[model samples]
Target: MNDDVRNIVLGMAAAGLSAALGWLARTCLWNRRLRRKQAFFGLPDNSESVLVVNRDAGSPDLAVHRYDVFALLELSALIKECGANADVITQDAARQGFGERTEFCVGGPGSNRRMAAHMRAMLPGMRVNVDSEPGPDRLAFQIGSERYRLEKGVGEYVVLARLTTGQPGRARPVFLFCGQTAITNQAAARYLYRHHERLARKHGNSTFVLLLKVVNSQAYGPDVTELVADVTRAAQAPLPTTAPARSSHRAP
Candidate 1:
């Protein structure tokens, strides 16, 4: 073969080999690393939590339903009803007008159900789930029930508060919060690292816990007081005293 033709053939073969190697490297070697990282972080194996969730869903203003917006709004309302300067634990409601008390986070690497368990153990009486699905805020779940539900496109906050008359174990009752609730309270650095160990134990990935000092203020809207009163009353009632009903915690 002519020298020029021979050189052209050799160049084409080299390019093909390079492309094949690159594809192999990405599919085999890099893929393994990704799987290991997921295991290390204890991230969910499902497409929803692991792949579908947009991690960078934070913004300077406004919040989304599946994101941290709902959590922020709910916590803000709670602060209004509980009175300012009261410390509270939250999952994602940090900064903005309403100050956060403290938070316990679960999910991701090092976050797991254990975090939820610890929080549950710490504050069994506070597992109040505010159901916002139906119009006119209502309280759902009674003692002995394990799961609770919240409405989509509805904004509300759920606090697992300890109703015991005395102080909680440790300096303050650790209010553990989770889910996509940490969008508004973006500046809770101190609270985020306080109980990280607990989060890590519960989840396989890096989990975060924030201990914030709840402060009193009019940061929340007018409907907060009524909602807070409703949930408190419902939680205090005996399990079988009344039938569980659907109620709206807020409108719009």
Candidate 2:
């Protein structure tokens, strides 16, 4: 071959090699990222998980909120991206123990009875008035001396938690999305999906409970969110029920 033809051939070969290397690097990085996400979500590749949807306790027809539905759709997409299957079930239909699968529980006590029961059984110390008619007068959440009330369009709060059992054999994680309203719940779910890496770095696969605040939700939808507090300790601890000295404990 002539020198020009040889140079052209060599240039094309070099370009092809570079493109192949770039593709390989991207594939590796993508795989690595997926692996980390799968681990963080505690769902192995193609393994099954549970997505627990909640119904309003007072609803006559047992309807799930639209925003909650949006949150679930988002969650479902995330699960699919991680190569995991989520068996969707309502809160009333959900059985105890989560049955060896990573379970995602969506709703507060007023919306999901299962979540209410979980709070009663697992998180006794934290006071939550989720069943009440939400307003400034009614206490939405109380942790120690601090109180949070739902202001609807103005501001709202949600509880995002990754609950892990101390049982000997259970390896799966339980994610709790307890929010003041459906919008807040959606925000919390989005936050967890988006920031799972940061959360995994800080708290690992272990238990973590956080209060997330959603400001001006009407304007921004579920996109705007802020981490209010790390209430892991207070949430997991048992309350002093024997003496009704200070805080008013409301039943779920």
Candidate 3:
């Protein structure tokens, strides 16, 4: 072969090799990210999950709020991206036991009976005033010493939690996107989708609860959000117990 031809062929080979190596590197990085996300979400590849939603209060038919519905769509997309199929069910229809499937529950206690049960069972420290009069603070969410009240059009608080089902071994995860309003619920789900990597890094695919604040949502929508607090410990802490009435039936 001529010297010029040999040099050109060698350069082409080097370029092809480099291209292959670069592609391999990119694939490895992408696979690593996908694996991390799957681990944090506890969704095995090609698995099934539940997407529990709340029923609209004022709707004659069983219609959910547009914002909550949008949040559910975002959550559904996220779950699909994470390689799981979600079966969307309403709070009344979500009667399955936990520790079986990965769940993405949206809505506050007042709107979602399943969420209300979760509050009583899993997050006892969280007290939601659902039966109170209709007002800004009607559905106040209190944890520890802080009370989050909804100020319409201005600001609202949402609680996003990635927790276990309180099983003996909490291997399954349930992501809760709960808030005062539907807009805040959407914000909470968006925050989870956008910040799962950061959350996984900090919490390591484990149980965690966060309080997020949405500012001027009427103007900016659910995009303007800030982390108010990490209420993991407080939200899951057991509620205070009263020493029973001297055990009326002790050792009968």
Report the Cα lDDT for residue 16, model 3.
100
Tell me, by TM-score, which candidate is best: 3
Clashing pairs in 2: none
Per-residue lDDT tens digits for candidate 3, residues 1-252, read: 999999999999999999999999999999899999888887768988899999775577788999999999998898888888889899999988775788899998878888888877788878766765676457667775566776766778889988785453355787888897889999999999999899999988667899888898989999999898899888887644532121111100
- Best of the two (2, 3) by TM-score: 3
Comparing 1 and 2 on lDDT, the stronger one: 2
lDDT of each: 0.33, 0.81, 0.82
lDDT of 3: 0.82
Least accurate stretch of 10 residues (summed lDDT) in model 1?
47-56
Q: All candidates' TM-scores?
A: 0.29, 0.88, 0.90
Question: Model 1: runs farther than 4 Å from truth?
Answer: 43-117, 120-252
How does candidate 1 score on lDDT?
0.33
Evaluated at residue 160, the lDDT of candidate 2 is: 93
